[model samples]
Target chain A: MSRFIEIVEVGARDGLQNEKVVLEPADKIELVRRLDACGARRQEVVSFVNPKRVPQMAGAEEMIAELAGAPGRSRIGLVLNERGWDRAVAGQCDEANVVVCATDGFGIRNQGASSAEQIATLAAIAAKRQAEGGPPISLTISVAFGCPFDGEVSEDQVVAIAQEGAALGLAEIALADTIGVADPWTVRKRVEAVRKVIGDIPLRMHFHDTRNTGIANAYASVEAGVRILDASVGGLGGCPFAPAATGNIGTEDLVYMLERAGFETGLDLGKLIETAHWIGGKIDKAPVSGLSKAGPFPKPAE
Target chain B: MSRFIEIVEVGARDGLQNEKVVLEPADKIELVRRLDACGARRQEVVSFVNPKRVPQMAGAEEMIAELAGAPGRSRIGLVLNERGWDRAVAGQCDEANVVVCATDGFGIRNQGASSAEQIATLAAIAAKRQAEGGPPISLTISVAFGCPFDGEVSEDQVVAIAQEGAALGLAEIALADTIGVADPWTVRKRVEAVRKVIGDIPLRMHFHDTRNTGIANAYASVEAGVRILDASVGGLGGCPFAPAATGNIGTEDLVYMLERAGFETGLDLGKLIETAHWIGGKIDKAPVSGLSKAGPFPKPAE
Candidate 1:
C-alpha cells in the first residue's frame, strides 16, 4: 500500500537552539526559505521562550513575523508555559506546540517546572486557546522514552500524561525521545500503548540520533501508524540540558529511506541534501547527515 | 517471545581494510585480543588475499596461525577465490566464509571474477570441502542489497545466487549491504524471499552504517528471524572501490539496541565501546560509533 508521510521540518527552531553559532534574523529567514523551497509544508520555526536564557533563539518574534502568512506552509511555535503561549499567539504562529516532560528532573531543568505543573499548564493553555481562538495547538510529551537526568522513564508515566493531554482536545500529540535512548521495539510498544490512550489524534514522533536509533524508531513509528515525524535539516540540534545528546534524525536521511521504499514524503531528496550542506555551512558545522557524505544512490548519472 | 541473536564482529578484517593507516600484524592481533575480551564468539578476523592489493589486510597468515584453535571462539577467514580458500583451509580457521558478488560489475572489481564465475568457484570449493572434510564453509553475497558499481541490485538477482549457494550445502548464507544502501522494508522482503529459496540454512546479515540505516536494517533482519549479523568495532570499514562508502554498524551500537530491546546478543556493550575507542586510538582516527561519543544509557553511575 502506498502511503504519504509528513515530516515536520525543525531545522529553524529545534535545530538552531543547540548550535554554538546564533543565526541572525535574516539568516534564519533564509534558512526557512530553503526549507520552503524543499517542499516542507509544515515546520517548527520558533520557540517562544526567554531569549536571555537561550540567546540562540533570541529572534523568534522577528523570524515569525517575517515568516508569517505563507500560503500553504504551517509554522509552529513551541511554547512551554502560558507566557510563551501568549507570545506565540501574539506572533501569529500557524500552530503552537506545547511540551510536557515525562519526568520532573527534565521538566525542572528544561522548562523550570514539574511534570504535574506542565500538565496543569497544558490544560490552562488549551482552555485559553479554546476561548481566544488562536492558532491550532498540539501537545508534545518530551522524554517519553528516557530522560538524561532522571534515568529510565516508564511507559506508564508517559501513558498517564498522554491520556491527560488527549483530554485537552488538541490538534496532535507527539512523543519525544529527548535523550535518544529509544529502541524500535520499545518505540513500537510505547506507540501502541499511547495510541490506546489518545484516540483519533494524529501521533507525531520526535527522535534524536544520539545512539543511532532515530531512523529505526521513525520506521517503527510509521509502521505503527504515526504519520507526522520531526526531523532537522543536516541533523541539526541537540538537547543542551541532556548530556551528550545529539541532533534529531536528518530530514534528508529520513526522506531517502521513505522514498526508496515507495513511500511519498513530498520531499525532494537532491534539494534536501543540498540544503543540508547549506545549513551546515551556515552553522559552521559539518552536516551529520549520511546522505550528505554518502551522496544519493545511482550516483546521479555522472 | 524471547530470542537470541548472534553478532559476528568484523573489526579486524573488514573494519581495518578501508583505513588509511596500515596496521602491523601485532597490532591486528592486539585488536583480536580486544575482540575476544568483548565476548565475541565469532569474528571475521582475517581475509586471505594479496597483500599488494589490500595492504591493510596483510599478515593474515601470521595472525590466523597465532590465533588458531581458540576454545570457544570461531575465527572466520574471508576467501574470494580457490587460492584464498586453500589458504583458509591451511590456516586452520574455525570457519571459512566465501564471498560471491551479486553483480558482475562488483564481482570483477572486488574479486576479479564475474558473478557466474564466482558461483562456479563456490561450487568447486564446496565439492573440494566435501571431499577433504576441512573447516565448515559459509557463503556471503556481497552487495546483496545494492552495488556501488552496478547500482540498484534486484532481489531476484540475490535470490538466484542464494538458491545456488544453498544448494552447495554451506554452513550459512549472508547478505551484505556492501555500500550500505538497503532500507528496512526492502531488507524484510528480501530476507523472506531468500529464506524461501535457501531452506533451513541460517541467514546472516552484514550492514554498513554508510547512510545511517544499518541499525534499522539489522532490527528488520532480526524481526524477519535472521539470527546472525555482522558488525565492526567503532563502526569501521569502507569500500576502497566505492566512492564515499563508510563504516559498518558499530558492534556496541547494535548491542545497545538489541540488549535494550530484550534480545540476547551475548556481547559486552561497555567493552565494545572501549574497544571502539582503543582501535580508534591505535589507528589515530576518532571512532564513527555513536555510542563511543554518546556513552551508554542509565548514566553508568558516574
Candidate 2:
C-alpha cells in the first residue's frame, strides 16, 4: 500500500446541503461527531452561505459554532464569495473551501458570476487570506470535467483556472466532475495537464456516479498522482442542476476499492457503512452506495 | 470508428434463466423479437437445461422452435451437459453455446463437472456435430477472470482450457467475468494470455458490472484486439452462486461506450434503450442500466 491518502469527508456539508429537507443544528453536530469518531480527520462541516438563496444552509453560523466546540477533528467550511468568506473567518473554521465553476453557465447558475469574474474574485480572496495570516483556503474548481448546460468543458479552461489558483498559493486544488461525465482517459489527461501547469501543489478529485464511472475515474486520478479525494458518505450528494445526476462516489465504496488495491485510506469499512445506514435512516430514501448494499467483499466465515 | 463489434445479446437466455420469476412463454418470445428488432444480429434465445433444476428455463424448446422460425438473425441456445446437447440437436438451434467454468468449484456448482471434464464433454459434442454437419458450436469459458469460492483465478488455467477448446475447432471462445472482479490491468494480461494460446479464434468478453469496472474492462479488452462482446439487456444477469452480484454490462450501455469511443457496434442507441425499457416493464422493475437512466452521452436537445 502507498502512503496514507487523505479522504476529506464532505458529506456533512456538501452532502447535506443538497438535501431538500434542511437538517437541524443538533443533527448536523451529531453527524460531524460520528464522522470524527470514524477516523475522518478533516471534514467539510458547513457552508457559510446566505439563508435567502440556500434555505438548507440557513443556519450555517450556528452549525459552525456548535462544531467548533466539538472535540476532535479539523473542520472546514465552503464559501462562494467574499460574504461567505467573511462568515467563514468570523466562524473560525480551520479551513475555507472557495469554489469557481469552470464554465460560464454553471458559474452563473452556481455562483452568480462569469468564469473570468469568479476566478478574479477567488484570486483576490486567496491573496487577502495570504496577507492576513488567517486560516488556509482551498480552491475547488467545479464543473472542471463538464457542464450540464454548456457541455464538453475544454482542458485549456480547467488548466487556466488551476494555474490561477496555483499562482495565488491555494492550499489545495480540487477538480470536480460536477455533471459526472468524465471517463478515465479524460480524467488522466486533464489531471496530467493540470499537474504540468500547477507544478506539484496538492491535487484532489471529486466525482459523481451519475453514469456509474465515478469510482473508476477516482482510481484513474489516483494513478495520475492525486492523493486527496472528496467523497460523500453513502454517496449522498447530487447536483441540483443536473437532473440525471444521482450520487457522488460513496465513501465506504471508495475506501473498499482503495484498501483492496494496496492503498491506505485510514477508514473502517464496517463503521462507515454503519454511518451510511444511520444517515439513510434519517433521510427520506436509501442511498445507492455499492458497499452499503453488497457489504464488504470476502465475508467472514459463519 | 473501427470495424463493427458483434454484441451477442444474451439477456433472453442468460439473463432471465437465473431469475426467480418464470416469465410467460409469450413474454419470452416477445422479448427476443424486440431485441431482434433493435438490430441484434445474434441472440441467445434459450437454454436446454432440465426444468427440474432450472424451472424458469422449462419452456426452452418451445421458445427456441418459435425463434428459429424467424428470419435474418442467428438464434443460439445455451447447453450444459450431454442431455442439453441432445435437446439442442433435436431443436436445430442456429448455434449451440457450450459453457465450461474455468474453476472447479463453479464448474461443479454450475455444470456438475470439472473443467477438464467439461472440456472433454464439449469436444465430444463438437465432434459429433461435425460428423452430422450440424450448425457451428461456440464455447464460453465462464469465470475466466475470477471466481467467488476460489479467489484469484490464474490465467494459466484459463489458457489451458481455451487451448483445448480451440483444438476442438470451436467457432468462438468467450471469457466470462462471472463475479465481476476483474480490473483493466487484469483484463489486459488475461486476454493477452488467452490470445497467445488460441491463435486465430475470435475472442469474446462476457463481463458483469457488479463492481462498476465492467465497461472500463471492456474498453481494455477492445484495445487488446477483441471485437465480440456479451451483454445482457438492461445489465440484468448475475451468477446464482455469487451473492449480491447484479448488473452485467447492459447492451445499450455497452453500445453507448463503444460508439462514443469511435468504435462501430452496428447498434441503434435509441432502439436499444427503448427495448431495454420494454424489458424493464415486463419484469416490473426498472433495469439498473446507466444508459437507460441517464440516456446517451452528448444528450440530444429536447
Candidate 3:
C-alpha cells in the first residue's frame, strides 16, 4: 500500500562493470530501457572509469548518449574521482554515485586513496557539482558492514563518513555491505548508528548475497527504517577488487521479500524473475537467486 | 565464553530420513559415531516410522541400538504416532522427539491427523512416557513459523500448542520452520509468543536454509531467548513430506554465526565442516553449506 520503498537497480553498471566479456554500448542501452519498462525509476546505468582499467565500462559516454533521449528513467553514473565526475557531468547523467570505503585497504584498492582522502575527495566532488548547478549527487560508503581487509568495521567510522557526506548536502547516504558478510544484527546496528548521525537524510542499503544472508539483512535494515535498497538483477554484481566477493542481493529476490512482508516495492516480482532468467540466458550462466530457483512462497498444493 | 548454547545435531535422523536414496544401517551407525566423536553430545539417530512410507528410516531399531552404545552421547529417536513411540521405547532411546504440525494440511500429510488430534496424541504420549518412567521426551511443532500448505501461521496457534506441550510436562519444545519461509521478524514474534505461553520451557529452533534466511532467522531466535538449535551436519535434512523443501541449516554454518556473534556454541566449526565434508563424501554429494564453500569470515589476508 505504501510506495516509500525505492529499488535502485544497479545491475547495468555495477553488475556489468567487472565482466571479462565486454557488452556493446547498444546492448547496455537496451538493458537500461528494459529495466525502466519494468518500473525502475532510478538505475545506475554506467560507471565513468578509465577504459584500460575497466574495459567493460569504457563505453559509458556512448551508452549515455544512446539513452539520452529515452524517457521516464533517472540514469545515475558511478564515479570514482574528479575525472569520472567530469565524464558523468558531460554525459548529462541524472545522478552521480560516489563511493568512499570504510577501510584503508579497500579504499586504496578501489579508489587509490586513503579513507580520509577518499571521503574528502567525494565531498569536494559533491560540492563542485552543487557549485556548478549540476545534477544531484549521492555518496555510498562501501564496506560499511565489514571489510575484506579490515574485519568488523566500527559503527563510529561509518557514522563519521555519513555525517561528512550529509554536511556536503549529498542527496542520499547508502551503506554498502561490499563483501556480503554482514548479519542482521550488524546491519541493524550500523544503520541505526548512521541514522543517528545523518538525521532526516535518506539512507539506502547495498548488500551482497555471498553468504546467503543478504535478503534477511535487508529486511532487518527495513525494520530499522531503511527505505532505499540497491540490488543487482539476477544477483549479478560483485566487487572485482574484494577477493571472493559474490553477487549483490538479487532484485527479484528482494522484491519477493518486501512484497510478502506487506511492503510495496512497485516492482513485479514475476516479471523481475523473468527478466533475470532472460538476462541469465544472455550471460550463459544460471542465476543464484533463490526465488528464481525455488519460486514464491506458499507454493500451490499438488 | 559462556558455554550455554547447544546444537542438537539432527542430520543423522531428520536430515537422512528425507533422502531419496536409502543408506545402509551400518553407514548410518558410522555417521552417528563420527558426529559423536566431533563433540555432538546429542545426536538424533533415527526415526521410527513405517518402512513402506519412509524406506530411508526402515532400520531405525538397529541404528538406535547401535548409537545407544555410543560413548558420551545421547541418542534421540523421532516418533510420529503411538506406533512409532512403541518402536522408540523398544529400542531404548535416550530421548523421544514427538512431532505435531502447526497447520491442518501439514499435520495430515506429516502425521496423518488433524492439529487437535496430533496435539492430543502428543500429550497422551508424554503422559504415558512419564507414567512408565521411560526416557525423557521432547516435543517439536513442525511448520511452527509457516506451513507450505497454509501461508502465515498465527502466533496464537503456536503459543496454544506450546502450552499444550508444556502442560504435558515435555522436557523441551522445538519450533520448526518446516518450509524456510519465515523472516527474522516472524521468528522473533513467534518465539516470543510461544515463550509467553510456556514459561521456562527450553525452546529450540529447527530451520532449513532453503530460502537463504535460515541462519539469520536462527540468530533472531537466539536473540529472542532460544538457546537450543537443531542443525543438520553439512545441511543434510529436509522434510520428505513437504514438497520442494530443501536442506536444513548446516550445523557448521550455524556454529560459525553463533561464535562470531559472541555466543558460545561449544562446537569447533572447522571440525564440524570437516565432518560435514566426510559425510558428504559418503552420501555422494557435496554438503550444501555456505561456510564450507566461503570459509569462515574475516579470512586471514593471503
Number of the top candidate by lDDT? 1
lDDT of 3: 0.81
Rank list by TM-score: 1, 3, 2
Model 1 CA deviation exceeding 4 Å by range: A241-245, B241-245
- Candidate with maximal DockQ: 1
lDDT of 1 at A2: 36
CAPRI tier for the interface of model 3 = acceptable
TM-score of 3: 0.91
Q: Best candidate per TM-score, number?
A: 1
In candidate 1 the C-alpha lDDT for residue B242 amounts to: 47
User: Higher lDDT: candidate 2 or 3?
Assistant: 2
In order, the candidates keep a fraction of the true contacts of 0.62, 0.17, 0.28
Q: Tens-digit lDDT track for model 2 on B242-276?
A: 45556678898788766755678777888888988
Could you give the DockQ of candidate 1? 0.65
* TM-score (C-alpha) between model 2 and the true structure: 0.91
Least accurate 10 contiguous residues by lDDT in model 1 chain A = A237-246
